[model samples]
Target: MSGSRNPRTAVVTGASTGIGEEYARKLAERGYALVLVARRAEAIERLAAELSERHGIDARTLPADLTDDADLAQVEERLSADGTGDDAPIDLLINNAGRGEGGTFTKMDPDTIDAMLSLNVRAVLRLARAVLPAQIARREAGEHGAPLGVINVASVAGELTVNPHGSVYGGSKKFVTLWSESVALEVAKHGVHVTVVLPGYVRTDMTRDVQDKGLPDFAWIPKERIVRDSLRAWAGGRTKVVPGAQYKAADNLLRVIPRSVFKSVARRFG
Candidate 1:
């Protein structure tokens, strides 16, 4: 909902690369002024400059690690800003920053597990909380001409039986999926939308190792498609989006198959 507002503003987290970067680019294409958040200062600054120059839109970079308490507080403050000053009210917030640790729950370093949870679960929840009040108020007061929303990037793994080696990561995403659905229901009456994107294997640096494992081409979804489909679904007021055709079929199969049968199959193949 790019509206009569002169320049709609969107805040995109993990904007340094991959799907986050794609969201920034696509939103810029739609003429949204962007606030790009990522830990890599240089990377996000470079991306901001490029997008600003190319699209003739304002693009600012906020460099912070979402897992750090101080850094997370800074972002929350930005999102909670009243927008009477230099900062503009955020029209959209994309919770795209997350991390995953390899190995089973017992084998992962306790600190690593904590960091992953801080990023994937705590940060996502806190940021959404920070942004929602303003959006709800705007809609209630009738000042929001365009859409006010949040799009949380989750994974298809969230809906499937847990991965023995990635239980925490999958669990975190399940929280996002379920939490987003609940929040979407709560905010719909207030004209605020929440969409959770559940993507399968996607072509990104995080999935480079899997890509090298020679999975079939259909198993990998392009990053662009995920962002595109996600934004489309959000604009249309849809709460959940599973972006790939093959993944859609797989998601359906996962739902119908009994857990005992899946566990048995995993014991043999996993």
Candidate 2:
């Protein structure tokens, strides 16, 4: 549907809630048969059923903890498979599962930080690796349209700009942003698009506490805006997307300032 020569299939990670769920919903609407991956089976299954019924598309769920090697492998295997006749090969991969390990670097628990890195960085990279071969093949075969894509959900905290609360989590996201853009360049010739979405705070289950922790309302971009902009950017084959206008300005500001200047601002603000 979405400019693809044929109907597409998508695998959306972290599909149980938040931006991932919205991606699943919107993709189904765009005529993608979906495979929703999340640790919580019931939530994702319910969502899949709802989407299938509403959109008249097949939606399946794969419940897996991406941090577990075996569980993660299952997702990789699924992405590797191009289903039998009339079945759509995966045309989109949304790497959205992530955890926020909040607090001062010294105060953060080692295990929590490890879990965050495993999901936010390692899983994202691995999943993108798993999907690209088939995506590239399909593009070369002339079976898909411009930019069969991957969307890695990075965060604005990863940019060079000052983020008062950003710490270990920021480092992990910076890896995502850079990795996605580099990969995008290598694959663009093959017509495989990759976008690293650098969204600021959004209203999601993950960010509920951040809202209560005195993060101002102005800093929040609603989930709808994030989905809309992310899809738009992905379609345009953008290397990265900063969903909100404020975050766009922040991204622009970060580009011009020296690291030393931003560091001074963070230290002063914190």
- Measured by TM-score, the strongest candidate is 1
Q: What are the lDDT figures for the candidates, one per model? A: 0.89, 0.86
Residue-level lDDT of model 2, residues 186-213, one tens digit each, is 9999888999899898888877777788
Please give each candidate's TM-score.
0.95, 0.92
lDDT of 1: 0.89
**How far does residue 29 in candidate 1 sit from its true spot (Å)?**
0.4
Lowest-sum lDDT 10-residue window in model 2? 1-10
Instruction: List, residue by residue over 1-270, the lDDT tens digit for candidate 1.
Output: 224366889999999999999999999999999999999999999999999999999999889999889999999988986577779888899999988666777788999989988999999999999999988887776675677889999999887665632888889999999999999999999999999999988878777677778888888899999999999999989999999899888888988989999798767766
